[model samples]
Structure formats: structure tokens, C-alpha cells
Target: MTLYETIFVRRSVRKYDKTPLDDETLRGIQKILDEAERIDGQTGRFEIVVGSRVKNATAPHYIFAFSEANDGAYANVGYVLQKVDLYLQSIGVGSVWLGAGKPVESAPDYVIMLAFGKTEVPLRSGAQDFRRLVLGEISDGDNAVAQAARLAPSAANSQPWKLHFEDGKVTVRYFGRGLLKAMLKKMNKVDIGIVLRHIEIALLKEGKTVRSVTATAAAGGGDLTAEITYVD
Candidate 1:
């Protein structure tokens, strides 16, 4: 299935077979990580290592993301890695986002990691398999984009984002939640990026071409926002 179709069936796979992937498969995944797009004005780095290099070995491989600490950077990491997550599953590999995971030799800029390997788990049947907020709660309208984007995973399922659609673009704003404001703020930023990818794919599936994607900080340091413009 294409990445767009994979989104509906994908799930966070925690139990993976311990066998390492072939060198060719690992290299192909590395290439995907290297070429994945980022949120504008953000610079993030990625690395693929064996499970032995990570603190928990749920999977045989882990892709670690590193970037400067900030909303845009964190969001960029999510935007890029979510593509890898979808692609891995599209090709029969299983993956899951690891927020609490750490590398044995950590970089100061590390943001998050994705654990992936072969698995026995099955993909979800379709959109019905996802347990998420209704479209009205997360977006302004029940368009196809909102439907697909709502399924994007968040830290602890916080889903802290609000989407505003306009003539030629959609603006994603960070909507903070939970008692731990400090921690949720960071993960929610990543969630914003993940949803952005879903929005882009949904738009493309609707026969729209993305013109540009830009990220910016709200005035007075309020919401962190990313705007995506497209042409029909």
C-alpha cells in the first residue's frame, strides 16, 4: 500500500521479532530518514542503530532523532520520522514511537526515537480501528484532510492541536493540555508535525499540490504554528 493508505491501517507495534533486518533493508530505511522532509526553518538529524545501542530493546533497530530544543525543531523531527514510520510498515516492518527511550550514547540534542523491526502483529483493518477524537474536536471542518490527520498519534494521545483551514492553506496551532504543562508542550509540538504530514498526504490524495510549508513562533511566545499552502 502507499503511504497514504498505510496511515489508516498503521498501529504502534510494541512487540517485534528480535531478528535484525538485512543490511539492504536497514540501508534503505537510513536513506528514507536522510531524505525525509522537515518543517521549514528547522534542522534535525537522524541515526539508525542496533537495539543494543538503545536502553530498551523492544525492536532490533532504533532511529534516533536529534535537534536543538525548540517547538519548530521538535515538530520537524516528528514530520520527518512519521514518514519513516509509515514507510516501514508499508514494507512489512513494524514500528513504534519511543518517547521515553534513550540511546546508550546520547547526544545533547536528542529529541526522540522510533523502534522498528520485523513483527507478528497485524495492521488495523481501517479507520474504524483507530480510537481518536472526532473530527469536530480537532479541526474546523470534517474534510478529508481533517479525517486523516486526526488519526495522527500524539504523546499519550494528548492530540493537542487545532487546525484552521483557509482559502489556500491550513494553519496548525499548538493547543497545550494536561497538568504537566512543561512536558506536554514539547510532545504536543511533535504531534503537530505528525498531523501536518497526514494533512499533506490527504491533500495530495485529493489532487492538490503543496506549495510551501512554514513554521513560526506565535507572538509573545504563545502557540507554535505551522502553515501549509497548496495549489489545486
Candidate 2:
């Protein structure tokens, strides 16, 4: 399935077969990690390692994401890795985002990791399988982009984003919730980038060519926002 199609059925796989993937498959994943798109002007790096290299191994492999410590950097990690996450599932490999997982050899800039391996777990049937906010709650336009992006995953399922659509442009605004706002601040930024990827995919599926993707901090650092300008 195409990444766009996989977005509708992808699930966060947890139980993975312990066997490692073939060397060729592992190299393909590494290539995706090296080439995944990031938020404009941000640079993040990813490393694929054996599951034993991770502190809590759930799969036979893990990809450790590293970046500078900032909102844009964290968001860039999400933008880049979400593509890899979708690609893994599209190829019938199981994958999950591990926010709390760690590399056995830690680095100062370690951001997040994704766990993956073979699995007997199945993908969800369709959109009905996702427990996400209604389009009306998270987005202004009840269109294909909104529908697809509504399923973008967030930390603790916080769903901390609102979408606005204008002619040839789409904007994602972050508005975090819950009493753990302070604790989840970084993750929320990452969540915004995850939705940004979904928005781009939806636009592409509709025959739109994205002109640019940009991120900006709200006034007084109150919120985070990303904008995508596109042409048909």
C-alpha cells in the first residue's frame, strides 16, 4: 500500500517477532531513515540498532533519533520519523513509537526511538479503528486532509492540535491539554510535526504540489504552528 493508504490502517504495533529482519530489509529501513524529510531548516539524525542495544527491547530492532534540544528539532524528528514509521507498516513490518525507550549507550541529544520487527499483529481495518478527535474538534475544514490528519498519533493521545485551511494553504496550530502540560510540552511539538506529514500526504493524494513547509513559534512562545503552501 502507498504511505497515504497506510495512514488509514496503521496501528502502533507492540508485540513483535523476536527474529531479526534480513540484512537487505534492514538496509532499506536505514535508507529511509537517512532520507526522511524534516521540517524546513532543521537537521536530525537517526541510527538503526539491534533491539538489545535498547534499554527495554520490544522488537528485534530500534531506530534511535537524535537532534538538538529545541521545539523545532523535536518537531523535525516527528516529521522525519513518521514517514519511516508508515513505510515500515506499509511493507508488513510492525512498528511503534517509543517515547520512553532509550539507547543502551545514551547521548545528550537523544530524542526518540521507533521499535520494529516481524509480527503477527494486524493493521486496523480502517478509519473507524482509530480513537481520535472528531474532525470538527481538531480541524476547520471537513475534507480529506483533515480526516487523514485527525488520525495522526500524539503523546498519551493528547491530540494537541487544531487545523485551519485556506485557499492553497494549510496551517496546524498546537494547543496542548491535560494537567501534565509542562511535562508533555516537547512531545506536543513532536505531535504537531506528525500531523504535518499526514497533511502533506493528504494533499499529495489530492494532486496538490506542496510549495513549502514551515514552522513558526507563536507570540510570547505561547503555541507552535506549521504552515504548508501548495498548488494544484
Candidate 3:
């Protein structure tokens, strides 16, 4: 299926069949990851691992995607990981960003995990049924991805992100206020990543491919930024 088709067809699949990713499918996943890393250079700042165990016991049959902390440096791990999630969906795989779970001891800095497998039952809803808002529909141009991003789940639904669009690039700014910042900083970029995932899904639906996506540290009072540049 085309990227847009996958976006429209994809859903947050939780339950999975016993089937694991075949070698061919795993190679395909690697290709997608490679492309995502190429498009977004932040891939080098972290690592991606695969495992059968779900960090949370309640959700077994899950695959893992983890990232190491870079001394709390440019915290765009979430943005990068979310790109991984959307790319997986585009290639006929299902994944859910696993936010709440037991941290792997070997990888304490690893912020997020993704559950993966074949769906036992298809999701009933279509992508069109999924929310995608237009520029004019929003209260401010700076909130380009607000509605769609809001749909992105955060730890306990804190929704700690503010987005801005300028120079044809969508900039995701973190709202690092309240008690949630210090507590959720480890996984905060993960939420931005999920929002970036939603934006990419919307762009693909519009028949455009994201040429590049980048995350940078907040300077002069800005939080992390996720910039999406489109293909012609």
C-alpha cells in the first residue's frame, strides 16, 4: 500500500497474534529504519533494539524499540521514535508507542518502547475517521499540528507540547512547565515524537513524503524542535 493508504488504514493495534516478524519482514523494517535515520540524522544519537517481551507484563507479545539518554542533551528522542512508529505503519506493520512500562536495567536512559505483531482482529475505524485538521480550522498558525498532536497520547495524557509552523517547516516546542517536566523529561521527547508521527501521517495522506525531520535542543528559551520538510 502507498504511504497515505497505510496512514488511512493504520490504527493503534494493541493485541497481537503469536506470529513474529519474518526475516524478510525484519529486513523490510530495517530498510525503513535506515531511511528514517537518513532522513532524520538524530538516529545516530540513539539505538533501536528488538525483543519479544513487552516491558509491561499486561501486554505480552510486544516488540521493543528503545533509545539511550545522551546526558539529557537535545531531547528529541520522542520525535525520532515516533517517526519509527509511522514508518512501520507505512510498511504494513502495526505498532503502539509503549510509554508506561518497566525500564530495562541495561538501558536505563531508554525512554520509549513500541509493541509490534500481526493484528488478531482488524481495527474498525478508517483513517478518514481519524482526526486531521486543516490550517484554517485552527485558532493559530502556530498550532498547526495541535489537534492531531493532541490525539497523540502522552504519559497520563499530560500533552506537554506546543507547535509552530514557519518557513514551511513545522516546529514542535515543548511546554516545559508544571510538575510534569522534571518527572517526564526522560520520556518527554517521546511525546513529541508521537506528535511528529501524526504530522507525518497527515502529510503522507496529502500525497507528500517528508524529505527530512530534525530535532534540536531549545536555545534562548525554546524547547526541542521537530522540523518536517516535504518532498516536491
Candidate 4:
């Protein structure tokens, strides 16, 4: 299925069948990750670990993402891994983002992970299945682009982002501040990257492209992690 189609059907499935996928299917998922984009532009690693090696979850396979510690590293990890998550679902495999577990040892800078296998759980049957903020609630554009951003997931489901459109450009800002900023800045950057992916997919469906996806400091006496400019 196309990424656009898969977006509506994907689910964060935690319970998966213990049966390992055949080599062919595994190879397909590997191919998807191999060609996936890493938006954070830093040193990173992806690995395939068997269920026996993973601690918290029981699944036939786990895909791991590791990156050198840096500003926005976690968000970059999310940006890259979200594509893999969608592709697995496109091909009928289950996946969920795991923030709690880690490699037993000898693993360093392990930023994030994805757990995948077969499952009986259904992806969203319709758009109504998504429990996301309305367009007016999170963004100024109130268009397809904003809708895509609205559905992007965040750590603890925080959904901490704001979208601005001006002069045909789209600027995303980290909206929560003060105690919220103190709490979720790094995590919000990661969530912004995930929203960026969603924006790209939605734009592509609409025959648009994102140009010069850049991270810029916010104007209000603090740092805003990242933003994207749109181009036809």
C-alpha cells in the first residue's frame, strides 16, 4: 500500500504473534529501512535484534535505532523510524514505538526502537479512529498539511506542536512553554520530526514538495527546534 493509504490503516500494535516472519518478508522490511530517510542528519545506527535479546516486549523481531547524543537526536530517530513503522503495517506486520526498553548492554546512544511482528489487531477502520486535536486547535493553516501534522504522534501522546503558514511557507513551532518546555523540549523536537514526515507525505499526495527543511531558533527569546518550507 502507498504511504498515504497506510497512514490511515497503521496502528501502534504491542501484542504480536511470536511466529517469526519468513526471510522474504524480513528482507522487504530491511529494504524499506535501508532506503529510509534520516532527517536529523547525524551519526545513527539501525539493528535487527531477536525477541530473546529484547527485554520488555515479546515480539518475533525488533528494529533498533541508535544515534550519537545531540540536540534533536531523539526527534531525528522518530523521523527516520516512522517510515519503517508505516511500511511494516503496509505489508501486514505490526509495529509500536518502544521508549522504555534497551539493549542488554554494549549498546550506546540507543535513542529509540520499533517492535514488529504479526498481529490480529486492526488498524484504524476510518479517520474517525484517530484521537487527535482538530485543525483549529493545533494550527493556523487549517488545511491538509495541518491535518497531517495534527495526527503525528508524540511521546506520552503529548502532541506538543504549533503550525504557522505565511507567504506560502509553513513554519512549525514548539508550542508548549515554561514548565511544558522544561519537560518536553527534546521529546517535542522528536515529535516535530514525526510531524514533518506526516507533512511530507500529505504534501506529496497533493503534488507538493518540502524544501530546505531546517531547524531554527524561535523568535521569542528561546529556541524552537525545527521548521519546514514548502515548494511546488
Candidate 5:
């Protein structure tokens, strides 16, 4: 499947071709994005804003993904919108997550923005193109799911997740502390969301379903963000 192939080849594209996406294509993308799996109980919204109002880039459009100001909103936004990112790349559209860009918002709660448009850069050729942590460093075990999670993108390339699988549930644990820990908390959740997206797509490609994902404590008793159970 192209979506599965996109998982391995997609990369953040900053340069755009300046040609705005057509209305049909935009509507199609919006519809596809609306089908994205969101975190349970995490309420959010998405808007397509075009023009020079968005600061810091020249893309033809910006996808403003945000949630009601809350503790885990940013992570939720990251989780949901990455589906759009992958979808766009799979169909030859280019995009980049804009963590630092500011939008002219009517409200003060816009959490994250993605700059998207036409571009000439090709989909990544293979794993060699990804500047990411090795599989062994991120997971205690190896499998198709773990390999997908290993390729998830993270803030500042700080891949904070440590995975360990037992039975059918996969536990995602993190590492950090103090002020740095507090700062990376949101980013870590974003990382988990991204990783989960990878795992979800990987499993779906094999005719399996992710039954449920729940929060739990690590075996040694740390903050395990989630435990996902899948059925084939």
C-alpha cells in the first residue's frame, strides 16, 4: 500500500513550489484528514488557512490544528494531524510541521500548524535517508511494529521513547527529568502519538486491528504513557 510505503519515505519538506493546491484536492485532503484516529476524549479542531498571514514560511496553505487549551492538547494535535502529513506525502503533496510558526488566529488556542503545498522533492528512497535512532536503541524487541515506531519523528530529534512488548500489549516508556522533563513532556506525548500512528498503520496493512490503547505504569514503575493491544 502507498500509505505503508509513505511511512518509510516521508520527510519534512520545507520548500514549496508556490502553486496553491486546487479546491478539489484541498477538499479531498480535508475529508481524508477528518477520518484520522484521534485520542479518545481529546477534543480538537482543524482549519485550512491560506495567505501571507502565517509567519515564517512561503507555503500556499497552512493547516492549523489545535485543541481547547488543555494539558495534552499539543500531543493530541500531533497525533491527529500526522495522518494528514502522511496522506499528503503519499499523494505527492509536500508539508512540514511548523512548531515555531505563529498564525493570525481569532483565538489564543491554536496549538500547531503544518505548512503544505506542492514541491519537487521526491519521497525518501529508503531507511538510509532517515536520520533517526537505531531500532535496538528504541525498542527492547524487534518486529514490524517496532520498526515502524522507530521511524517516528520527534522534537529536536530527542527520541525519548523506550518500548518493551509483552503479550499483545506494547508499553511506551519515556526518559527525562526536572525542568527538562516538564518541557519535554508535551513533546514526548507527541512522540508517542507519532509512534502510535506508525504502529496503527503498520498493523492495519497486515489485516490486524489495534483493539485498545490504555495508560499504565512501567513494570519497574515509571510513567508508561500507553499500552496498546492488537488483534490479528
Candidate 6:
């Protein structure tokens, strides 16, 4: 299936089966990780780490991902990781973002962990519905983006983003109020990128195209913006 198709079918999978990852699936994931690293480059500033755990240790099997904590970067990490997660799902691998209870740890200044594996539990009932938001009913243009932005995951799903729209551009502001505010700012960038990804996906599904995404801090006090222009 295509990447967008994967995006549509992918859901957060929390429970796992006892089955182990096959050689082919492992190779495919490795290849994608390599390509993602190259595409992300130094400008994007993120990394994906894959590891395995003993059965019953936590999840039967998993892949852990992290990136250096820098301003406006976590959002990008989320964006990139979402794509990686989608690709994994396309191959019949189950995955979910590991939250507070998982045994994952962070380095001194790093954003850590996305759990991937095969699940025994049936897919969650409302998982697909969770991705939906009302675009037509959004009165504040920026909030429309923010509504979508809220869906973008952050460290522990903290969601520390605020958006404002002006003229033809959308501005994304970082609130930086969480405990790890500095780390959150970097993660927020990847989150912004994830938000951008959702905005483009939603628009394309509606037969619209985004013209551009430019970053600006017009809202002041560390607020970051992504000005999106629509295609006529």
C-alpha cells in the first residue's frame, strides 16, 4: 500500500501477541530507518533507534526511537516517527507510543521511545475515530490547525502547542509550560511537522493542496508559526 494508504489504515496498537518479528520485517524496518535518517539529515535533527526486549519483560517486542532535545524539534520527531510507524503498520507490525508506564528512559536531554511489536489484543474500537476533527466548523483558522495540532503527539502526549492564523499564513506557537519545557520545544517542532503532515493529509483528502509552510514567530514569547498557503 502507498504511504497515505498506510496512514489511513494505521492505528495505535497497545497490546501485542507473542509472535516475534520475522527476518524480512526486520530487514524492511532497517531499510526504512536508514532512508529516514538520510532524508531527515542534519537540518531536521532527529534519530530512530530500534531494539528488542525479552518476552514478558514489558511488551513482547518493540522498537524504541529518540532524538536530541532542541527547540522546535520534537514535532519533527513526531512527524517523522508517524511516517515510520505507518510504514511498520503497512507490513502488519503493531505499534504504539510508549507512555508513562513503559520502561523506557531518556538521556540527560533526549526525547525517548516508541513501542512497536505484534499484538494479541484486537484493535481498539475508537482508534480510527480518534484521528477525525471538524475542519469546516473551525471558526478561527489557526485554531483549525491547532485542532489538528492537538492530535499531534508529544512527550507523554503533553501537546504544548498554540496556533494563530493571519492573512494566508498559519502561525504555530510553543507554550513551553510543561516540566521539560526546553526538551518540549525541540519535540514541539517535530510535533508541528506532524501537525503540518495532518493538515496536508486532511486537505488533500478534501481535494485541496497546501502551497507552502513557512516558520515565523509573530506571536512573540517563543511562539513558532507555520504559514500555510492554499493552492487555488
Please report, in order, the local distance difference test score of every candidate based on alpha carbons. 0.88, 0.89, 0.57, 0.74, 0.75, 0.53
User: Can you write out model 6's per-residue Cα lDDT over 44-140, one digit (the tens) per residue?
Assistant: 4334333443223445555444544543455455555666676777777777765342334444544545667677544334325554434332224
TM-score of each: 0.96, 0.97, 0.68, 0.88, 0.88, 0.62
Which has the greatest TM-score?
Answer: 2
Name the weakest run of 10 consecutive residues (lDDT summed) in model 5.
215-224
TM-score of 1: 0.96
> How are the candidates ranked when ordered by lDDT, highest leading?
2, 1, 5, 4, 3, 6
Q: In every candidate, how many clashes are there?
A: 0, 0, 4, 2, 0, 24
lDDT of 3 by residue, 159-191 (tens): 666667654566666665458778887567666
Judge candidate 1 against the unseen true structure and give its global Cα lDDT, from 0 to 1.
Answer: 0.88
- Please give, for residues 55-160, the per-residue lDDT of candidate 5 as tens digits: 6557999888767754345556767787888899988999887767788655577777788999998888887889987888888989988888787777666777
Tell me each candidate's RMSD, in Å, in order.
1.2, 1.1, 4.6, 2.6, 3.0, 5.3
Most lDDT-accurate candidate: 2
Residue 78 local lDDT, model 5:
69
Is candidate 3 or 4 superior in lDDT? 4
Task: Please give the distance, in angstroms, between residue 142's alpha carbon in candidate 6 and its true position after superposition.
Answer: 10
* Candidate 1: tens digits of C-alpha lDDT, residues 1-232: 9989998999999999999999999889988888887787777988888899998678999988988888888899889999999999999999999888878887888888999999999999999989988888889977888888998988888888889999889999888766655777777788888999989989999999999877777888878899899999
Model 3 scores worst on lDDT over the 10 consecutive residues at 135-144
Please, what are the lDDT tens digits per residue for candidate 2 over residues 1-232? 9999999999999998999999999889889888877788998888888988998798999888889888778888889889999999999999998888878897999988889999999999999999987889899999999999999988888889889999999999988877867788888888888999999999999999999888778778767889989999
lDDT at residue 184 of model 4 (Cα atoms): 68
The residue ranges of model 5 lying beyond 4 angstroms of the native Cα positions read 176-184, 214-224
Q: After superposition, how far is residue 124 of candidate 6 from its true place, in Å?
A: 6.1
| Error at 145, model 4, angstroms | 1.5
Q: Give the TM-score of candidate 3.
A: 0.68
